[model samples]
Target: MSPEEAPARRRGRPTGSRAGAPETREAILAAARSEFAARGYAKASIRGIARTAGVDPALVHHHFGTKEKLFGAALEFTFAPALVVPEILEGGPEGVGERLARRFLSTWEVPEVRERLIAVMRSALTEDAAAAMLREFVSRELLLRIAAQLDVPEPHLRAELAASHMVGMAVLRYVLQVEPLASADPEELVGLVAPALQRYLTER
Candidate 1:
């Protein structure tokens, strides 16, 4: 272990350079992601994730509090909310759509995140529980938060519209892999999608 990692180990923390968590928490998150991807949110269990992480189920709960919180936290790290949220919030309401579009699409640019997101999206489509979990997480974490920050009327509806646009793009570009859109350049896609998102949040 490196000198910096040694102190963390001595204090019983797992060591990793991942943005969130020490070694153990990262391990749990990794396990959760894999489990969620493979089993879908409806079928995935804390016990299964714990088993994969080689930790006790209680340890998983202790780290994450609840399953909703755990999945949300895991998604947050994969989505890089900390890095993306502030960028979206900056520069006021002007051109926020482009920023949101760029940042949102950027999340899928990563191989790992994209792969897991696909499986999770599939689960959401086929499973009611999975759909609820995803709807709540995305709305609560990304869409609602962004819309509220802009002081929009009917923030919930606006958030859903923005999310619909973004999600539709994701389904075509990443999940369904539709032609043209799937092969399109990132900036081109951003330009094509941003206007709709802008109107959703900024217009009415």
Candidate 2:
């Protein structure tokens, strides 16, 4: 083949070594995060993420399997809220409030969590599907687990209210960037907030 044809052929494939699967996967995830944040799960298209990532759409399919799975991974990477909550609840009912507050504050302090929270909040507000997805995750994974552990009469309602409190605080502090509240120290915020959370979890 001529030199010109050879260069064009080489450029057709990804540059660098063929062992760039990991890098490609990371790129797709980064792009997926942005796309999902902007368009949300309902409107976000895999083709768009692939275009943003500078990879073939097939590669995205190969890596993530489907848009829903990709969205789940992106959400997991962003928030990780579901990870620590169970452990906090397991610690004992008495300290549940303080533990919940501490975990919430600490998680929000991370930039990615803040971004993810904002994205989810925006999607929840604007898209019916996104809102449903958020509600399902909160109810099925987060609240139900805590409700089963607690002795509250209306555990579902209490768990929901607790979620609202946490989500509201997140909206105010991270998304709205409200003064004093956003800048407040984690320990101080926990001290102020834990009692409310505890009451929600433990009160009859």
Candidate 3:
């Protein structure tokens, strides 16, 4: 080969070089998030995520192990609720409504979280197992924790109501993208919604 050709020779595995592994993983995660958000858990495919990421389908399996694990990671990264929710509830029951509303709205406004939530909700509507998983997470992690902290007699009922209110608003604003509601100021929403939430937590 010519000297110029020799100097230009590729140095390592075409795509699997050690230096490229982290980049590949990030690409796969970004593509997987988009796929899961658009397709829902039941319809999203590892092959499709791999195709979008421009990697071998086997690479997706190698990275994430299984579709369920991928979905969990994608959702966790997208929503990041485990980090936010507890912080929101940290101020105790008196501040719960405002804190919850602010945090929920802020979290949902994130593009990835909004998309992931819509995907999860869609999956919950159509797939029983998906719905159960969603319910279990919300119930065990969110509602129950908040309920236990409250002084109300029907803490569970109040928690459910609060959850319903937040979920309903999310569906309308994020998923449906309904005009004014979709574009409404976050503070305005907090003002409007927090009272109802506060009442649920405090009232008989």
C-alpha lDDT values of all predictions: 0.77, 0.79, 0.77
Which model is ahead, 1 or 2, in terms of TM-score? 2
List, residue by residue over 1-204, the lDDT tens digit for candidate 2: 678557645766453232256888889988988887888777889999988988878778888898877876676666566667777888888979998888888887888767777777787788776677667777777777778888888988987888789888888888887998988888998999899999998878
RMSD to the hidden true structure, all candidates: 6.1, 3.7, 4.4
lDDT per residue (tens digit) for residues 110-142 in model 3: 776677678777877887766777677777767
Tell me the TM-score of each prediction against the true structure.
0.74, 0.82, 0.79
The stretch of ten residues in a row with the least summed lDDT in candidate 3 is: 11-20
Q: Candidates sorted by TM-score, descending order? A: 2, 3, 1
Per-residue CA lDDT of model 1 for 1-204, tens digit only, reads: 678778755754342233244787888989998988888877889999988987767678878988777887776665564346645766777898898888888788878878877877877788876678777777667765665676678877887778777878889989888998898888888898889888877785
Model 3, runs deviating above 4 Å:
1-14, 18-23
Tally clashing residue pairs in candidate 2.
Answer: 0
Q: How many residue pairs clash (N, CA or C atoms closer than 3 angstroms) in each of the candidate models, in the order given?
A: 1, 0, 0
Question: In model 3, what are the clashing residue pairs, if there are any?
Answer: none
Model 2 accuracy (lDDT, Cα): 0.79
* Residue ranges of candidate 1 with Cα displaced over 4 Å: 1-21, 56-58, 61-69, 79-83
The candidate, 1 or 2, that scores higher on lDDT is 2
**Poorest lDDT segment (10 consecutive residues) of candidate 1:** 12-21
